[model samples]
Target chain A: MEFEYPIEGGDFTRAGMASSQVKKVLKQLNIAPAIIKRIAVAMYEAEVNVVAHAFKGTMLVNIMPDKVFIKFIDEGPGIHDIDLAMQEGFSTATESVRQMGFGAGMGLPNIKKNVDELQISSVVNKGTTVELTTYIS
Target chain B: MKLTEVVNKLELEVICGEDLLENTVTGGYCSDLLSDVMGNAQEGQVWLTIQVHNNIIAVASLKELSAILLVKGLKPGKETIETAIQQGIPILRTNETAFEIAGRLYNLIRQS
Candidate 1:
């Protein structure tokens, strides 16, 4: 199964809708609870990043019998330092975002932790793409 | 502790899923950070957060939480409530602060 969501940037409130739907779908599919939790966590982190950092973006989720794939593509001022951004406590979220209990710099790192494979590419002036895959078996 | 007792002691309103009030909750976690909640919360726990976003419901569902308490008198938006309802997660609204709710729930569950 496959699903796609348009993540509206700066709309912090609606950030986790995609991940929520994904979790529901996986549960209905009878996926293992542990794998479902891992995917949900990774997807939620990436979804939050789209709202907190990007101008706007899309989250694509593709599921198969063996693995699930998630891709986040955003049109924003891309990450200047991917390494720094990947650190656990290196967020640039505004005060408002911080007040909502996010932007503690754990987004990308958490995504990385939960996924089996994580690939990220970015250009300073253009955009960024994050690909995350989790094996079902 | 049963969710009903938490509701009674905390003086919270059941915004949705009143039928779930009798469900038992094993522990309580209070945090507005989605990632932290995702990482820390165990199954059957009650999540006490001041955040009213849709993702909060998502995290609770992912964690298999018994219910979610929106503290500090925060009212969730229509979309948030609808999503929680669809997920079958009971959401309660409380006039108490997150700290107060956490403390009271701790005492209540500890005694029980």
Candidate 2:
């Protein structure tokens, strides 16, 4: 099954809706709670990134028999250094984002830790795309 | 132990989720960082933090956390309380700091 959800940047109120929706799908499919938890964390972090940084984003979820794949595409000033962003303490978040208890530079690291595979590509002034996969079977 | 018992013992104010006070407490985690709670907090664990934003509710629900305890007398915004109610995530508040509440909670759970 496949699903797509839009994320509006700077909209803290709606930040995690996409992840929450995908979580519901996982539950209805009776996916193991352990697997769901991992995906939920990854997806939530991915969603928060878009909301906190990008202008807007879309989450495309592809759930297969063996694995669940999610692709996040966003319009924003992309990461200047992907490696630095992946570090535990590096962040480009503005003051407001940090005030929300996020922007500690652990978002990408948290996503990486929860998912089996994570791929990130970005253009400095263009946009970013993050793809993650978790084998649920 | 039940969330109600924890609230009564700690004199925590139920900011929302009155009906959810009966939720069973399996464990507890104390963190204000969203990433830490998301990555490390276990299911059914009561999260202790001073974060009063709406995202706290999202994290609590995503982790299947039993409840959220806001220390240092911090209170969530009106929208946050609404979100907590909608998401069925209980929010408790206390005048003590995170350290104080965490220490007390640790002892309370350990004793039981």
Candidate 3:
């Protein structure tokens, strides 16, 4: 199965909508609770990253019998240093974004810990794309 | 332990989701950072935090948390309470800080 959800930048109010939808779909598919929890955490962090940093983004999810795949493509000020951004305590979020209890510099690292495979690519002035895959087994 | 029991024991105010007072409380997690809770809090756990925002509800729901316990006399916004009601996860409040409440909650659960 496949699904797509739009992500709005700087929209803290709706940051987790896509992840919520994915959780529901996973539940309907009888995915194990443990796996679903991991996916929910990873997806939510990625979604919030878009809302906190990107101009706009889209989440593409594909569910298969043995694995689930997700791609988050965001158009905005792309990350200049992927390695630095991946560090647990590195973030370039604005003050307003951090005030809401987000932008703790843990989002991307948390996503990495939960997902089986993660790929991140970005261009200086264009955008960033994150691909995450998790084996369902 | 039932959420109602915790409410009564801790003297927590039920801000919303009164209908879910019967939910079970398996454990407690105290954290102000959203990602920490998202990455560490387990299902059925009661989250204790000073942050009062609608996203708290989102994290609680996504993690299948039993309820949210607002610490240090913090009150949630109108939208936050409404989301808690809609999601059926109780929003609870307390005058104590996370450290105080977490300790008490730990003893309560441990004794049970």
Candidate 4:
């Protein structure tokens, strides 16, 4: 099954809606609790990233028998240095965003830990695309 | 133990999802950082934090958490309560800080 969810940038209030919906679908499919938890965390972090950065983004989820694939595509001001962004304590979040307990620079690291495979590619001033895949088993 | 039991024992105020007070509490996690909670918190656990944004509700729901306990007398945003009600996860409040509440919750769960 495949699903697509739109993410509104700078919309902190509705940040994790996409992840929540995907979680519900996973639950209905009877996905194992451990697997669901990993995917949920990855998806939520990706969703938050888009909302915190990007002009807007789209989350595409492909659920197969053996694995789940997710893609987060967003517009503009892409990462200048992917390595730095992947670090545990590096973030470009504004004061207010950090104050909300988000933008702690743990988003990408957490995603990487939970997902089996992660690919992040970005063009400075252009856009970013993050692809994540996790085995269901 | 039921959520109501925790509420009564800890003197936590039920901010929303009153019907869900019957939900069972399997464990508890105390953290204010969204990523920490998202990365470490488990399902059916009661999350203790002072973060009062709507995303807290979103995280709790996504993680299938049983409930959220806001400490240090922190009040949740309007959207937070709304999301909690929508997600069927109770949003609980208390005057205690995260450390105090977490310790009490640990003892309560252990005793139970």
lDDT of each: 0.87, 0.93, 0.93, 0.92
What tens digits encode model 1's per-residue C-alpha lDDT throughout A72-132? 9999989999999999889988988887788888888888889999999998868899999
For model 4, residues B12-102, the per-residue Cα lDDT tens digits are 8999988988889999999889999999988789999888888888888888889999888998878788888888879889988888889
Question: How does residue B58 of candidate 2 score in lDDT?
Answer: 92
Candidate 1 off by > 4 Å:
B77-79
Tens-place lDDT digits, model 4, residues A94-130: 8999999998899999999999999999999989999
lDDT of 3 by residue, B27-104 (tens): 999888899999899999999988887888889999999999998899899998887787777999999988889999
Model 4 segments beyond 4 Å from truth?
none
**If both were scored by TM-score, which would come out higher, candidate 1 or candidate 2?**
2
Candidate 1 lDDT at A129 equals 96
Measured against the true two-chain complex, the DockQ scores of the candidates, in the order shown, are 0.61, 0.86, 0.85, 0.91
TM-score of 3: 0.98
lDDT of 3 by residue, A11-116 (tens): 8888897899899999999999899999999999999999999999999999999999999999999999999999998999998888888989999999999999
Q: Is the docking of candidate 2 incorrect, acceptable, medium or high quality?
A: high
lDDT of 3: 0.93
Which pairs of residues clash in candidate 3, taking residues 3 or more apart in a chain or in different chains?
none
lDDT of 2 at A117: 99
Please tell me how candidate 1 rates in CAPRI terms.
medium
**RMSD of candidates 1 onward, in order:** 2.3, 0.9, 0.9, 1.2
Stretches of candidate 3 above 4 Å error?
none
Error of 1 at A37 (Å): 0.5
